[model samples]
Target: MTDRLKLMQGNEAVAEAALAAGARFFAGYPITPSTEIAEIMAARLPAAGGRFIQMEDEIAGISAVIGASLAGQKAFTATSGPGFSLMQENLGFAAMVEAPCVVVNVQRLGPGTGIPTAPGQGDVMQARWGTHGDHPAVAFCPGSVREAYDLTIQAFNAAERLRTPVILLLDEIVAHMREGVHLPPPDELVIIDRPRPAGPPGSIGAAPAYRPGKGEVPAIPDFGTGYRFHVTGLVHDETGLPVNDSRVADGLIRRLHRKIELARREITFTRACRLEDAQVAVIAYGSAARSARQAVREARERGVQAGFLQLQTIWPFPAEEVANLSRRVPQLIVAEMNLGQLEAEVRRAVSGKAEVIPLTSGGGRLFTPEEILGAICTAPGGRLKKVVHQ
Candidate 1:
């Protein structure tokens, strides 16, 4: 039920979606699988009255995004593994300063540039803990081309709404695959902009810069708008002044984490298929979920009670739902491109409630439905002993 339908690669969908979400500034370096996002933004941003800068490297790229966001522009950047690693310093800064920006990591097989063109979910844990300190984070994982577009927009929205850096974690397969998708009309889609400070820019506002009045998110005063504010990576007070007092630093950390904790219900995303009466469950995300979904179908055909859960939001781990699902089934099978990143988290959540099995690969290709189905069939006897231990 849409007028506009086009066959677009996942990167193309993400670029357009970011623009639609009002991303006016993009700073990124060229990296495989994610370079198309920068290319499209370079050509498209200017036409939409936005700015696009090709930074010297990944570190500079994310640094520019944080600078732009501080100046009151909705900004984003895209990069693959090695580049994503370089951005970790600024990523920590963006979180500390509460800069509302989006970072897209189209993951490739990597510790240090393992395979540029091949897909991998090895960045699952990195996206959550790559940065140095404890800070709030919201990361989205998409499974399909259309989902890439939707989740990209969600990344921007979450950044603005939460007043923190958000991540769109994609695999190379989703970034390169092309599919025709019918999108909803503009009016039907919901958009959220960054909150503006109620107090005058130059005046001593009643509330401090980082203090939230009603919602957990603080109102932002644009940099050029005469707002007297200080931004720093060090722990800061509500007034934006760096503090050495452990009490003040403790409060700031608590607030930073509490905001995300309170919003967990609004952030956790998962899709369950035929899990109502499943004897075994398949847990996966990104491209891995595609195979898991198909395996569920094939297993059902073979008279197996199997189901699949596609995780859309990777961080703030969907613990409650995962725990419930573990209680529902006798076993849970985790599938991913990496050896086992998400599997460890799921295993921790399940906590012996079910026999956890891992169907993983580090060879840059996606796991087959056959592999997932085999796990489901042999789940009872626990024949697959390759569980990822913490």
Candidate 2:
């Protein structure tokens, strides 16, 4: 018999996943819809020989996690909309310094505490471009409670493997709702360790200890490993030293981008339901994916050829897969919590090959199955009619 399990809130699952992923340090401040993550982390991390600290604010929370990560411990932090916004500058710093860490944002209503307890997907675009500069970051979204566990592990692995900050984007509904989740055996899951320095301890010239080779992600040495290096936010060369030379700046920027971009194939993940013979496809991510799946199922029940493309990896935008599906489907509806954030990217990928419809909601509210069904039915040239839920 298959080993299947019981109910778990998304936040609790996140805590469990972090422990399983070897996260040794967590620092976060409590905020609605995301407080459970911090609470569970605080309670469970100690039992797993880990540490948890509740900082004064989100800024201090992220700063502490960065410090812990630099010390060679897997570190993480959790927050919601307003708190996530506070961590932006530090998140940018982590990206610039190529620190390995994870940040979980259980998205709530946005734009200055719009709704504390309600759910919202308004942070979709913020996850991508909230931080300043050209640094690369990866954000993953999980639709189910089980995925909350799986993807949290994936988020930490991606952070350590790529030597960058990874964001796990969860919505209020999924974060608060309880569902069955199977805890995978340790051996069954693949965990990624950060790249380590290959050269001798004292063999360093001018290059930084953490700087990697061309087209490669460098291993970051632990803080007290007798290897001395500098970490800075300014654009720097291999030595992590601020440089004014145009060629050095150019090389550093290109290499920073190339390392992550080249790893795109490893970073992208998606789920397709009933798309093999569908005339219409629905693209959704995060919590919205759950309702989209229901809408697709209902349409299919009525003999409509409808399917769903659920994104697990939101950043790096699975363009190829989406574009391919667009070619096969006549109509594509992009559903999100925001008013056309990922939808814009979907449009670009489809390139007018299919009719792209955007279904959005704000202020921490998620799209209902009825709303999604209506959007699908009213799509131009689609066979769907407005779905009325009583």
Candidate 3:
């Protein structure tokens, strides 16, 4: 791929990447830290022969995206804390009905508008569990401006290939950061559109439109594409009718999860340095991982065998990888801007095979490399200096 450098903000790069990924429709309400994404799409989508709509609210925004996806258009939306909160139900609806779309949440400090412009990794858990029930989610977290663009394209690809709602969770630091990025030529980038049926439409020989595809994903015929199918939140069979029978519901739920769960390696991506030969390892994602990487390097320079694991994919947490890393490293440092969310998951995965130490700050400030290295300096006996900033 030939290099074409562009001075772009992370949010703008994401919007450009979305267009390159063939996102023809965008429906979203303006929200702080993420409104630039909507603004860019509004201006450029029509020029690309696509559609963009500023909806009434976050809920309606996602609702329209879901409808567009069912109509066989690649769709997306962007939001922040409160707007992300408002999107939960429709997010679930998209998951339940097997709609493919992307949702970007540029996070801010929150539990109810604690801070708007400040950075926080508070929405990590919400990206996975904000929606109700036992639905599966594939969420990506990018740590740099370049990664923000690259991962946004991957997010759209995952949504198209898996037939599920994919979330790109970005902290304010990564969302608003401006830097030079070498973007590849649009034609050189591999664009995977949603797969279409092979056979001719409605002749003597044709497969049922509702037939389950790979990963138990139902093959949806685009609206007005001659084939019609039903969609509902209720647990249904291949035909998509509401069903209450216990066995039927159980099978339906399994299919929904299989799309994301069954292809773990394909969907999960991470960056690790010196992990195989390290005694101490730090695990982090989003902006927190940026500091974690620097801290690990500084610790290694101080004659400590330190490693860093940066998560590019946050959801469907890499259980097998985390479990194996647990037995290898004597101490695992789980760092975050929020209060110990991924730490709990790592602890459970490690299962006491190694010491699980958490480095956290919830008052919206990101962890510095010194702060993380401090945790590394003081071990089982020493407390993490200022675990909560507030």
Candidate 4:
């Protein structure tokens, strides 16, 4: 049986879902829009037999979470744009070490803390290219509080399964919004744990800790569990020690990307609403999608055949599906809080298959449904569409 519907804020849902996903440690510094996650985690984690820590800064926060994950604990951290920027270097370090952990970025107006309490999705590109190298990036953006809860658990599972850091991107709109949701029973939820080396730490042959056992991801044993292995930021081999050879470096980097690229089908997720036999389609995500959905309904009311595409997975973007939509529709409208961040990706995916129209906002407010519906009606065939509507 499902639990009774309970009202919860988006950030609170993320914290609760993390707990349900077997997160035993949380390290974070409080920031606006995202502080509630840390606050709720602080109060709830200890009671749930978990640990919570408030680090001096965002860098230390992510570092601690990485360390905790290495020591055999499911760990995560939450922050906003400014804090997320501070964690980029260590985020790269986590990728290099192949540590499985989750990082939540509750986006706020940015570039340097533009607005602490306002919502903005300018981090869409940064979430994928924040770090300084060619490492794999996995990120998800939720459109509602319920999606916040579901995607948080999925983020943790993806981290463990992919052996990399997974980002859960939220905005001030959803982060603070309250919604009623019926949570699934704990036993019914699927929780994925990282693969651990067999035979405890030292019972069998002294194999390399990073050696791939079954799949591309290695089953590294927990630190201090009688396993002797090195972990470093430099390019390393299966033994986890630093390597200097070019071939070894190339191989390591390629494997890091290949593991994630090969699993694209499993990681990418999206929702197409009323796309069949539509004249126009709107691609939106996060809070912006809430408006796009209503716009679609309103457009239908006005005799405009409009569809909505909700992007749940932002990075490693659902390009193929977007291309498919472009083939079917004559025009595609992309609405987002940021100025054409993801719209650029959609254009690349469309590649002249259809007309690309962007309705973007750098301002810290959401676009209204009427605003989107206007774009849907006036996109490219404004005069002709009006005649058809009449």
Candidate 5:
């Protein structure tokens, strides 16, 4: 453990984890809080017999990643808020074509570059619905550098397994923070490559490239691998060719959503601290969870039964977990770096079962433990009654 331990920043952990997960191609533009990831990939990928390219912009970056992934290279890209917005079109394209790729978004304060060096969780809703049209999304948000490494690999695994784009959402605070991480040995890592075609169900002939197998995932072969197939962003049939029929379009889109919706339980990752028997609970993710964790500990020290729930997966939102926690506790506090983006979702999940309180910051700063502890100690009745804007 000691030998594998290293002091690494969150961005560095993500880059290393992608490599460990078999990523061989990275194409991204440098953006604050996320540039380190691209830099590390650029510096280290070539030596690992991998390839790295700095694209002119975020749009091109994600497009290149999709192309590389289709070409059979485990590929990814990195960006912050503004860049993430630019890549939305291509991100949707990747989802439509069932391309396996990972997009690391180190979120900074934004609505047109609000603040590059500041942290914000405002993109929670955007990450889930930024792209046009209806499409399934898989995204992970890590609360620490260690989780950053672990979840980065999980992101790639999910992308490959689902044959869809995955988002690794980070905030500026976590991206820049350094922590001592004990990386797992390479042998212990569970790496999963996308399923390849083995011909159709019977007959022993080539399988339809976009045909759905178990879990609605298609075993599309890699480009240039001698298997003839087509990949397109437009609605298509099982053969991967574009089709204009409403029935074909409807079925294809629904199946794409079904692949992820059915796997919701498997994709959602969460950590709860002392939530088993608590009078009050705090739900948070990313950097905000760090402070929330500290606050939970201090609340217990002061004889308050405060629990903490940290969301490691942001998209395909953990509505069930939040709903369950709401039924258990009379009050739930949601701490985040945005203006209640996820707080709204928690309210919808709780469905009036509990009083949902929001402790939010407007980016650039983080909540101190005392801030969250105050909210926990002052819950409704005698506790919190309104949003606590930090």
Candidate 6:
């Protein structure tokens, strides 16, 4: 590991990592808890010959980023709360068109700009299903400044490798927290480049022409190239033209789902600490995972057989690992900053094999160590009691 460390805010680290990952375009509107990312990108991206645009609104910002990405430049945008809501339409468009780009959502309390500057993990489920339809997108969360850097690069890599929009889900606390992060040496990082077309530039003879072979991710031809293709929200065939036929719709939909689901092995990552012989496991992610880690350590010190499963990838849910752990452990506590979003998934995965408990709080607050321990103490059959807040 590189020993050189400097104190950096999470948003700064994300902007720095995007630049290092070869992202050359950023377009976003200013929003609290995430504006720092845009500010840094505007200043720093120019230094690296990258383009930055501060658009009028979040919708335009994401639309511009998608446009840039289709032009063969890695692109990104950042927002929070209401801004994130504004970007949903374009985000859905990006997913539908298979536009590869990165979107950083520094989440704040919300239903409608609920708390712009306060920390909250309320966007966990939104990150998965905020966009319409059955489109699958990869979403990752970073609990620390170092992970803000690492996962941002991973988000870009995932977008290019899968030819889809990838979301970097960060809460207000993680986005604002300043911590020492050791910058990695340039040569040690692995960066992914998008697939390129195999044949000569204008080899495809017809309009809306392209080939994405069976079980293979297609190379996206950049716009401004001689080869013309259609981009739209409507279901389209492999050639990129809108098709109203059911067969074409079915194939397109299945491919979109399969392409992401089949790549789960590459997308899923989680940390299991002291789970080998534990009887109780705490499932957590994002900044909430930080508190859970501390709680688990303290629980272990008190002779409790507690362990932690810290998720790095939020979407796709790591079901297999969660199921296996659920079976091994007698009780499972799903701690999140939302009201049981992930806990529901944990219950489905375990299938009643273990006692599933939810410890959640919303509106810009986190579950503290003492609160977690209290949950542990009050667990029925040694499992935490489900606490619901309306």
TM-score of each: 0.95, 0.94, 0.94, 0.96, 0.95, 0.94
lDDT of 5 by residue, 169-230 (tens): 99988899998888998999999999887754333556788989879998888888778788
lDDT of 6 by residue, 1-390 (tens): 657679999999999999989999999998999989999988888889999999988899999999999899999999987888888888888888778999999989887878888888888888888988877868999999999999999999989988889999999889999998788877999999877665655675332333454344667678777666777788878677777899988777778878888789888989889897777878898898898889888887876778889989988788898999987888888998878888888888898888998898975777788888766656653443356889
Clashes of each: 0, 5, 0, 0, 6, 1
RMSD of 6: 4.7
Model 6 regions lying over 4 Å from their true place: 204-210, 380-390
Candidate 4 residue lDDT tens string, 1-390: 866789989998899899999998999999998999999888998999989999999999999999999998999999999999999999999998989999999999887979999999999989999998888899999999889999999999989988899999999999999989877779989988888876765667546887765558888888888899999999888989998999998888888888888778888889889888688889999999999999999888777788999999998889999999999988999999988999889999999999999998985898899999989988763223536444
TM-score (C-alpha, index-matched) for candidate 5: 0.95
| TM-score attained by model 3 | 0.94
lDDT of 3 by residue, 310-364 (tens): 9899898987788888888888989999898889888888999989998889847
lDDT values for all models: 0.87, 0.86, 0.86, 0.90, 0.90, 0.85
In candidate 2, how many clashes are counted?
A: 5
Model 1, C-alpha of 333: deviation from truth (Å): 0.3
Name every residue pair that clashes in candidate 5.
Answer: 378-383, 378-384, 379-383, 379-384, 380-383, 380-384
Candidate 3, which segments miss by more than 4 Å at Cα?
1-4, 203-206, 380-390
**Clash count, candidate 5:** 6
Q: Which stretches of candidate 5 lie over 4 Å from their true place?
A: 1-4, 199-205, 381-390
